[model samples]
Target: MTRLPTPAPEGDPRDGGRRLMLVEALAGRWGWSPRADGDLGKTVWAECAL
Candidate 1:
């Protein structure tokens, strides 16, 4: 599993939304699986399978 770091611009709602959109795009393009760990909202990670 590979980790893709998606750091959203702090204190910006639009950038956060864009980050979410990016995650969705990646998931659609490469079929990445997103799983939330116990710590939510602090990190966004997409697992890549080769």
Candidate 2:
């Protein structure tokens, strides 16, 4: 199973950049690829198929 860092709100410029960097690091280091992602009111999530 792949693990993703808890997401940061995209509304903040700094957090948005940090979120992208985390994703990139996971992709580069572990070959993790996101299959889908979205916001659900109070919650947000991204999934990757193994």
Candidate 3:
């Protein structure tokens, strides 16, 4: 029988960095909604949620 490679553990700093980069790329390409008070983190989170 064939076996698949084991997946890497989650929440590693490297993984976090990769996730952040992915989020940034998505935000840049699609653009985020405007925030009521110009909160960047909130905007990023809102975009990421979508």
The whole-model lDDT of each prediction reads 0.52, 0.45, 0.43
Off by over 4 Å in 3: 1-15, 28-44, 48-50
Off by over 4 Å in 1: 1-15, 28-41
Candidate 1 CA-lDDT value = 0.52
List ranges where model 2 is wrong by over 4 Å: 1-15, 28-50
Model 2: per-residue lDDT, tens digit, 1-50? 75644446656665333455565545533333454464321222344445
Give the C-alpha miss distance for residue 29 in model 3, angstroms.
Answer: 9.9
Q: Rank the candidates by lDDT, best first.
A: 1, 2, 3
Clashing pairs in 1: none
Over 1-50, each residue of candidate 3 has an lDDT whose tens digit, in order, gives 52322224465554323454555566634333346686633233524446
Q: Write the per-residue lDDT of candidate 1 for residues 1-50, one digit (tens) a residue.
A: 66654546667675354566566666634332345664434444565445
Clashes of each: 0, 0, 0
Q: How far off is residue 37 in model 3, in Å?
A: 23
TM-scores for every candidate against the unseen true structure: 0.32, 0.25, 0.27
> How many angstroms is residue 49 displaced in model 1 relative to the true structure, after the best TM-score fit?
4.5
